[model samples]
Target: KKKKKKPRGSGGGDPGCPRVSKPSDDLQTSRKSGFFSALPLRASLRGYGFCMAALFLFCFGSLFYQLNGGAPQILQDIRHYLGKKFSLPRALPFPSQVVYNRVGKCGSRTVVILLRLLAEKHQFNLVSSDIHNKTRLTKHEQVDLMKNISKIPQPFLYTRHVHFLNFTRFRINQPVYINIIRDPINRFLSNYFFRRFGDWRGEQNHLIRTPGMKDDERYLDINVCILENYPECSNPRVFYIIPYFCGQHPQCREPGVWALERAKQNVLENYLLVGILEELEDVLLMLERLLPHYFSGVLDIYKSPEYKKVGNLTGTVRKHTPTLEALQVLYHRMRYEYDFYNFIRDQFHLTKKKIGLKSASQPPAYSSAFLRELTLRTPKPLDEDEELESDLEDKWLLWCPS
Candidate 1:
């Protein structure tokens, strides 16, 4: 006003006068500045709130589900939480191989250990069920998931407790298929006693019914519950043995019908390399032939401890003879498949004389420690050499049981 103040809303204004503008421009500028100034802070707070809400929901949901006695669901939720925290690569970097292990208390763990060690040494990928696989998924669900996930066509090694039907679909050109079969009588006895009192939890008495149960129920009872409920049995028998050697139990056994048909089909279709756990030295030799680069003498494989362990045998309630007779009866009922296993053994040129193999025909070694170091955790690399020495001592005792 003193020196021609001009219009206050104009671009140029007096120094002491407050600036005024057209209502439209003022509104537009105010809106823009306001938004820009508050945008980052608002976004950050929103993100934090979202995470907190998710965490709260998950914890509340888990507790609610557990309280409802939905054990499977609770287990699944826990797995999901752990999985998200420890996600592995979708595919391993190097080409991986598959191994199908059959049942027996027959050193299957040692084989798994060897394969894991080899995979690590060669920088090849080892696909394990626990790390990341749909093994825990139901059969139908797992098959569908594998089909979709397999389309990526990356070279990765995967191993799991899979059935023959599921395993045969993979186009493994020269994959190694391995299985170890023990004497049917011994195996049956092992199965029977292990189910009775081993650390295995779940329906135990359902193993051998007290008569009047339907035959199919009997089969389901024996085949399904016994194998599924026990961890040791579940791992070797259900996962590897039944699938790789004996196929799923048939609805009816017509003549020429057998338990291992599907496994036979898979073997014919794929380059399967079967290994007898009893003849481990021969198995190692076959591995040398199959995978020369990795198995070559660069590493002394023989230094690997003997599979047998000397330990106390539990569940010896009555005289061994009666138990042996009962096992013998069961063995004969399943002898057809046992004969097939023997044929495979013969084809491999594995001989009992080559390795001091044990059989049902051989008398039981009562003093032998059959349960040696069963609870020992897998030794770390730094402790392996020492563990090996201890195992060697244990093996000496096992060999000279009496």
Candidate 2:
């Protein structure tokens, strides 16, 4: 053994040599084994990163799709794949051909009735807002509604309580634009009574006590006061009248002046049609002429006894003297709207004599019985069956792949 040890030093006794010791052989084996062991972990980590990146890409794509009203199949596939990967309700399509600017208490309900009749009579593809009780929606809500409308396939009609200027950018060709206006003074008063008394049942005596409250707060009960006094508020944009009486956004710099100019321009530029609430019968006549196939002989203007005494204040004390000051304020505020309305009235040949009624005529023909009939016929709690069957059919056709 001593002779072998001496020989080992000269040949390969160096501690650093791999063959010199058993420990060195064990170290090399451990490193080689560990290298293969870590291979699966490294591959798994790469796969996890790839999966994360793919998931991120999918989420980003979905967000963009949702913002643009989603893909056409989104609504169609909702029933099939709702509980799986994508679980959101589909957005309903809105008609874009017909635009209805519903001015409150201006016989808008009658206009809605006529639109429904037109839809039924012509069998034209149409869509009406789901507004059952509320008169107006917030501006942002209206904008969102319009965005949803923009996604619909064209060649369709829609009715809603929207401002005329709100839909100017829709780029629809030869779209029918219709609205109703009323005598400003009478309109204001009617709005007041409805808000204060909750119908014609409220006492007329409350007019004087109304001034004590701020203009905005005073008309809480009256829808008209809210519309008229909206301009005076710090945020005039909140009012429903802002789009119609004020003008389009960004162009509404000077509320009083710009609104008037814009209103005038809108009336001139578009295929705008006006209906005087006071001359609703004549309005029906004009509509019959314009949409002959759909509306001919459809308007049943049944005169009501209640409307006969609408403007008769003989027995009631004259509490609000002329209400001229208030009227003038509103007229000046909405000068452009008033002027444009007057011009439209003249153009349509809707004078007092032509309509066969004084400014003091009874409530619109459909104010009583027609409304009652409509209320009974339409679905109560509007949302229950607001699913328009025709609209759905049209949407299905639009969504069909080419």
Best-fitting candidate, scored by TM-score:
2
lDDT of 2 at 387: 18
TM-score of 1: 0.43
Candidate closest to the true structure, highest lDDT: 2
Instruction: Give all candidates' CA lDDT scores.
Output: 0.43, 0.49
What is the C-alpha lDDT profile of model 2 across 273-344, one tens digit per residue?
A: 676776677676665545443344444422343433442321222223223333334444443444455565
Q: What digit string (tens of lDDT, one per residue) describes model 1 on residues 167-273?
A: 44444243455555554444554544443434222344334423344544434434333323332222122222334444333311211244456555555555345
Residue 195 error for model 2, in Å?
A: 2.3
